[model samples]
Target: MYAGAMKDKRSDSRLVLEKVSHSYGAVPVLNDLNLVVDPGEVVVLVGPSGCGKTTILNLLSGYIEPVSGTVRREGIIRTVYQQDGLFPWLTVSENIAIGLRSVEDPARREKELLDLIALIRLEGFEHHYPHQLSGGMRQRVELARVLAGDSDILLMDEPFSALDYQGRLRMRWELVRLLEKRPHTVVFVTHDIEEAAQLADRVLVLSNRPATISRELHIEALRPRDLTDPAVIGAMKEILKELGLQV
Candidate 1:
């Protein structure tokens, strides 16, 4: 098994996966993978390279299906990707308005989209196309798109990886702020330890290839995490060790 060790849980979740496994012909990528995202909870998925972490997110977002397992989802899910994945031809307003098709009230839809842009702090750039925005701005627009959808859950795949140092910091803070307003369940995947530490309420650590949960870490630290705190460092090191890395 590519997965080193596994811990099985018996509890139920807002979303549940039972005996979940996936493969391609003779090769396998995930086996008996199990996890739960409680209603309105933020869960971050972390693992070493080639661990199939992104694959897990794709499955949950309905982009793909697990070969074997039962998936139970509460409501719609929206994704915010590292590349921002915005429509190149659409203006910011037009892109964020995609979800408005289901909403019948034109005034209400307009109001909500404007609120989303402001919440992500991308107010003045609403008319700009995706190509005209900066990296951070592009990400903000993508996040706004998700918010506009009023999704029940969010699947984020390394969305902040491409930002500059300060840009990532600001985006992290903004994310925390947005989550505070209307809490939604989230499954975020990232390779950065500190990023996980800062953002996730709970962290799921996975192993290589046929990935399964190797460990779960809860971040009890208050928002605006202290990067220099010894306690935080200890938790990070422990997770690195779980991934078979010497930290």
Candidate 2:
């Protein structure tokens, strides 16, 4: 696992949500929300199941407009959801190649796809179909597909939620390794505090419906963090407390 590199102070804010609020019909989901993600920083959102976490991602991705306030994005955004979103008929290499479709040169596109497959450690399975790979491998392909686009920001919503415990642990470490190689401003949403503690540079805790920022905690521990370490355990406890969970 790569150590958590100190974030460069010069990196600018890539995404900002200023006093943003959103609703479905008459029911509000997010209320007066404000967030800023610096370039190459990983921020995680954790809260009650329906506290507008996914709504925030939708707003950031421009899939939906905020009912009030402003949503400003400085660069291209890509999203990875809980589902892999892989094309059943396409091989791993082919699915990843979808992101490079706009590349005019066939040779250049192929080279890029090959490089991405290597980056995600899918080199051996490039020719394998989605059904042939494990769930974790499929998710890796999804991640590689997103990264292949060279997006400036990544919005991940419970991306590893469907994986088994061991798979989730492995993917968390794999994610850190991948991000170290290809950095991006990331906003990840997860219900798991341990996951948030393990991945986030900063974690934002949200309230129930009509969600608002309830608390913000920064994880100062280095990456490849040990779950048993006092710092990590302390951070997890604090986050759970914020979420009204007894530790």
For candidate 2, the 10 contiguous residues with the lowest summed lDDT are 1-10
- Candidate with maximal TM-score: 2
Residue-level lDDT tens digits of model 2 in 57-127: 99999999999999988776889989858999999988999878777888999898988998988778988
CA lDDT, candidate 2, residue 165: 94
Q: Candidates' TM-scores?
A: 0.90, 0.92
Which residue pairs does candidate 1 place in steric collision?
A: none
RMSD for all candidates, in order, please: 7.1, 2.8
lDDT of each: 0.79, 0.87
Error of 1 at 101 (Å): 2.8
Candidate 2 to native Cα RMSD, angstroms: 2.8
User: What does candidate 2 score on TM?
Assistant: 0.92
Candidate 1 residue 180 C-alpha distance from true site, Å: 1.1
